[model samples]
Target chain A: MIEIHDLHYRVGAAPILSDISLSLPEGSLTALIGPNGAGKSTLLRLMARLEPLQSGRITVEGLDLATTPTDAMARTLAIMGQQNSVASRLRVRELVGFGRWPHHQGRPRAADREAVEAAIDAFGLQPFAGRFLDELSGGQVQRAFLAMTFAQDTAWMLLDEPLNNLDVAHARALMARLAQLVQDTGRSVVAVVHEVNYAAAWADHVVAMKHGRIVAQGAAEAVLTEDLLSDLYDTPVEVSRHDGRPLVLHHHSHSRIADLSRGRLPDRARLS
Target chain B: MRFAAGLGLAALLALMLVSLGVGAAEISVRQARSDAWTMLVLMESRLPRTLAVALAGAALAVSGTLIQSLVRNRFVGPDTTGTSESAALGLLAVTILAPASPIWVKMVAASFAAMAGTALFIVVIRRLPRREVMLVPIAGLVLSGVLGSIVTWIAWQADLLQYVGVWMSGEFSGVTAGRYELLWVAGLAAGLAWVGADRFAILSLGDGVATGLGLSTASVMRFGLVVVAVVSALVVTTVGMVPFLGLVVPNIVARVMGDNLRASLPVVAASGAGLLLACDIIGRLLIAPYEMPVSVILGVLGALIFLVLLYRRPAHA
Candidate 1:
């Protein structure tokens, strides 16, 4: 389990994340959903220790983040952020091989090789294993980075906006793979998702944030209601069931207030 | 791997010997042995100068490779990092402040100053919120400019401008046996770097990756910087500042070869030696009795090569 308490992050005088406290249970897929400037990326970076926690306490399985060595934390948790601009000269296999670094420290053994190969196979990257990262498309590069994180083989995986540049089919495939990892392997995953439908369809737990604070969080079915999402995004929204999941309809032409005002016009409203 | 390195080593030796033999002096092998004075001049003057050039070239090249790897930047070098400039300032300080200071004292002072400059660069880089890697070399260039101006000002005030000019214009003319002994420090530094090549390569992956791999990023960076500073300082103290040998050689080697430090290190070293020696010979032959500085030749050639490299798009790795 990962726990964050009294998280207060400030960037030069303005508060980025204020009094944010949350706990992520073990063996679950939690999707962080929010609008722009919602601090989802900041929260993920803090959890990964990519940014220092200024006024908070974070612990993973009873080990305090401040006290645990980075290598030890890396062995337990792996993070892949949205910025995947790695030096393009590196080969796909070499990039994935870096995931084994925390274990072998560059002197890879047979087991490390096995893990790398497994990760490649898991991501269906065997065909492009020898290719350089520059040679691959954006979606293929995203998969390669995901394979690297998977190769780390940690208990916890944190992905920040993993679906940014991915096409529809690839995005669904990635979500399915993450869900399988959580369900079958009993590993935990936390991903910051921009598209709410992906979260509603796939996430076991949904966390909603606005202006750097969590507005709603719970089981997907409960927190993903129309009222909560409408309040969360400050826009009129309607939720309908699709394939036994909440399908958010937010792109309608008429506003809720406009519809209500027209309904009160009685027989004259039907003249048009 | 060891066998391949040995082959490279043999090649470097042959190049070194051939470079020593062929120079403007044109001393035939038989005549070199017949006259005692001629033998003495060749052995004492030409031999040490050649060896110093080779050692300085190799050291700077290796140091440049290490710096580039540690910073994960392509254009880094000892001069660009302000190391050689700071070292020159250190030497200048010693000459002005302590006129009676020994050569060893001056070398130590320069090494320490170079280390301090590198540490300052690292600190400045760490403090920036965005952590722009390009700023490192820029900061280094700024520091070099500042330190270089100070050195120049002091040298001018103290009437040591001639001495400073000689040191700044890198050449092999003044190198003799006693003066060239300082270059052994560079050799030792190169050896140390070679032994820690794996750690340096891991460091090229950035601090997070290196730290995640159980290596202390700060310690590794500090170690690599010290090695670069010490070697660069020693070379500057003995011969002078040899520009572009460090930057151009490593980049060319990495382009031709791969990023693997262990595999490319010797190639960088050899290429550095070969290029410097060829430049030195060209400098010697440019004028019959008088010769241009090796630094000038290297500077012009390096600029042309750099422009060519810039214009030519690199093929994807």
Candidate 2:
């Protein structure tokens, strides 16, 4: 379980996060959904302790982030940011091997090597194991990073926009793998997801943010209503059920254009 | 990799022997006449100078690799951080304050001043918004300018300008058994670098990942700064400013072998020694007794290579 209390983050004069307090249930695959500039990434980064906390307290399990040692925190929680570029040109396997660094520090034992190989196999990266990161496609790179995060073998995984540039099929595959991890391994996950449908399909819980605060958070079904999403994005939307999950309908601007064609009618007629 | 390293070492050994023979002394290479004069020249001048060149080259190259990795910048080196200039200032202060001080005092002062300069550079870098990778080296160059000018102005006023540019324009002509001993300390810094190679590689990945991986990014960066300062200061104190030796050597090594320091650091050291020794040879042979500074040749060659590196940046880069 991860708990954040009275978290207020300010960047210069602008308030990035304002007294945002929330508790993420343990072993739940949670989705963080918000419009642009809603501070979704900031909240994730703050929880991960990637950014220093200004006025807040975060705890993973029973350990407080403020007082816990970095190595201790690393053992329990692993976070991956959107753009994790390696200045060193490393192969996929080598990059994944670094995930065991916290465990072995540098010297890899037989177990560590096994974990690295398992991570590669887990991500279906065996074919590209020897390929440099630059040689992989964007989706492949994202999967490679995911493999590294998995290789950490922590209780919780915190990801900020892991599906950022991945295509629909790749994104689905990643979410499915994440779902599998949560179900089979009981690893808690908190991801900043852009495509609301993916969140609705995979996330057991959803936290909606707006204007630097949690607008709503609960079981995925309870919080992902049409009214909530429409208000969250400030755009008209519809939510309909698909395969027993909420499917967000956001492509409505064309309907307005069609309504304009509702035949008041002959002001501009085509050749037809 | 082992084969390449062995080849490099063998070539280096052959070159060391040739360098020993090519000096101003008329020592015969013939095995029959190993007389006192020949022994004296080899021990007192040729051997020490050659060893000093090797030490300085390896130290500076390791220093360059450390800085570039820590900063995550391809263009960064010890010079970019004003480390050498600050060290030069330290040496200048010692020269003026106590002209009779031993070489150890001067070396200590230079390294201390260099560490201070690097600390200030870190503070400045932290305060500024990090929008560009190029900004770091530019900031370092500017800081070097300011620090270097202070040394110049003071040296000029005191009429002790003779000591101002000791190692900046590198030459092996002045190296002898006693004068170049500080370079061994620089060699120690290189060994420390080798031992800490994994820490550097992890830190090079970036702050967030490094932190996430439980490594203290700040301390690792501090370690890198100290290594850079110590190596550059030692080299500068012993040999003067060897411009671009650090920048050019480490980069060429990284191009041939990737930045996994554990695997590549020894190679980097060898490449650095080979390149510097080669440059020194060219400088010596070009004018013979007249002697051009090795720095001059490296400055020209490094600039050309740098341009090529910039234009031919990897497609993924």
Candidate 3:
């Protein structure tokens, strides 16, 4: 389990996160859902120690994040950010092989090699394993990065905007994979998901944030309500049940023509 | 891979023999094999010169590879990043302040100066928005120009222009067995690079990813910076500045082998050594008896290669 206490992050004078505290359960798929500038990525970066904690205490799986060594923390949790600009002549297989670095350091044993191959297979990247990253499309490259993070083989995985650039099919496939990982391997997963339906469909726990504060956090069915989402995003949202889970239907419901015909211009459209 | 390395080794040996035979002193391979005086000349002058050329080339190229990986910019190298120029400044300062200092003292001074200069370059480039790939080397070139002019002005004021001139043109004509042994230290630094090849490769993946992969990015970056500074200082102190050997060799290797330093570093080193040996041979042959500096030949060739790299399809970020 990951625990946070008294976390307050600021950039210069402007606060990014303030007096935040939360606990994430182990062996569950958790989704961090928020609009832009919600500090979802920043919070994840702090937990992973990619960003230094200013006035916060975080512990991941019993190890203090501030005191743990980088290699030790790496074995505990693996993270993949949205922007992976590895601009070099790197093959997809070689890039994924780097995920085994914490385990093998430099000298890869047979077990490490097998793990790399397994990760490549897990992402279904075998067809383009030999190809360079630049040769692949954006979605394919996104999958390759996901494979690399999986090859890390940690107990916890944190991904920031993992679905970016991925088409709908790949996105759904990745969410299914994350769900399967949590169930089959008992590894805890935390992902910042922009698409709420993904979190609605797969996330066991839903954390909704607005203005750097968690507005609601609980089981997916309880937290992803229409009233909470509409309040969280400052826009109308509708939720319907599908396959015994909450399915958010906010896309077509907030049309501009319907709003103008109703004679009151939307506040968000005016500001933008 | 093993076969390629073996073939490279065989070719290097063959080139070393040829380089040892051809020099201003007019000693053939057969003569050196039979005559004792010719053999002494081969061991003392020709052998040292050849080894110095190879070692310096390999060291510069390795430093270039390290800088490129650390900066995550393909265009920057020791020469472009003001490393060589600042080393010259250190050499000049030592020559003017303490003319009787030991060679090692001068090398230490130069290495310290090179480190400071490179650190400044890194700091400046770090603040830069990294999207524009061409801006990095352009920034480096500006830094090099500034550092180089300062050295030149100081040399002129001290009436040490001629001495600085000797250090500026990378010529192996003056290299003797005892004078060129410092290059071995540079060679050792390159060897260290090979040992830590995987770490450096991870480093090229950027700070966040490298950290996520369990690396102390700062420490590894410092290690690489020291390697680059030490290699640059040694090369400048030993044979003056050999421009672009570092930039050209690794790039060509990367084109064929990609940037997996573990698989490609040895090839980068060997190719660097081989290319420098060939260039030095060309320098000796071009103006027979009266030799041109290897820097002159490398300057022209390196510039051509740089242009080609610039116009070629953009490489990965």
Best by the DockQ measure: 3
TM-score of chain A of each: 0.93, 0.92, 0.92
The clash tally of candidate 1 reads 0
lDDT tens digits, residues B1-317, model 3? 77988999999888888899888887776877789989899889999999998899889899999999989988888999999999999999999999999999999999999999999999989988877777888999999999999999999999999988877888888999899999999999999989889889888878878889989999999999899999999999988999889898888888778888999898899899998999999999998988989999999999899888778844454
Best of the two (1, 2) by lDDT: 2
Give the worst 10-residue stretch by lDDT in candidate 1 chain A.
A263-272
Report lDDT per candidate.
0.81, 0.83, 0.89
> Could you tell me which 10 consecutive residues in candidate 1 chain B have the lowest summed lDDT?
B308-317
Task: Score candidate 3 by TM-score against the native.
Answer: 0.95
Ranking by lDDT: 3, 2, 1
Model 1 per-residue lDDT tens digits across residues A1-272: 99999999999999999989999888989999989999999998898887888998999777798889987888988888774454424567877887887887667899999999999998899999987676788888888888988889898888989998988898989898888878988989999999998999899999899999999888899999977887888775667778999887764445544663344322322322
Clashing pairs in 2: B166-B240, B167-B239, B167-B240, B167-B241, B168-B240, B168-B241
Cα lDDT tens digits for candidate 2, B1-317? 67876888999888777777776666765642558778888889888988998888888888989988877767767876788888998998898899899888998999999999888877777666655656777888898889888888998999877778655567778998998998898999888989888888877777878888888888888888888888988888888888787887777877766677887788888878878888777777887766777788888987888778878765444
Candidate 1 pairs with clashing backbones: none
lDDT digits (tens) for residues B56-131 of candidate 1:
8888899989878766666668887778888888888898899899899999999998888766766765665534
Error of 1 at A129 (Å): 2.7
Predicted candidate 2 versus true structure: per-residue lDDT over A112-192, tens digit per residue: 999999999988999999887767888898888888889999999999899988888989999998998899889999999
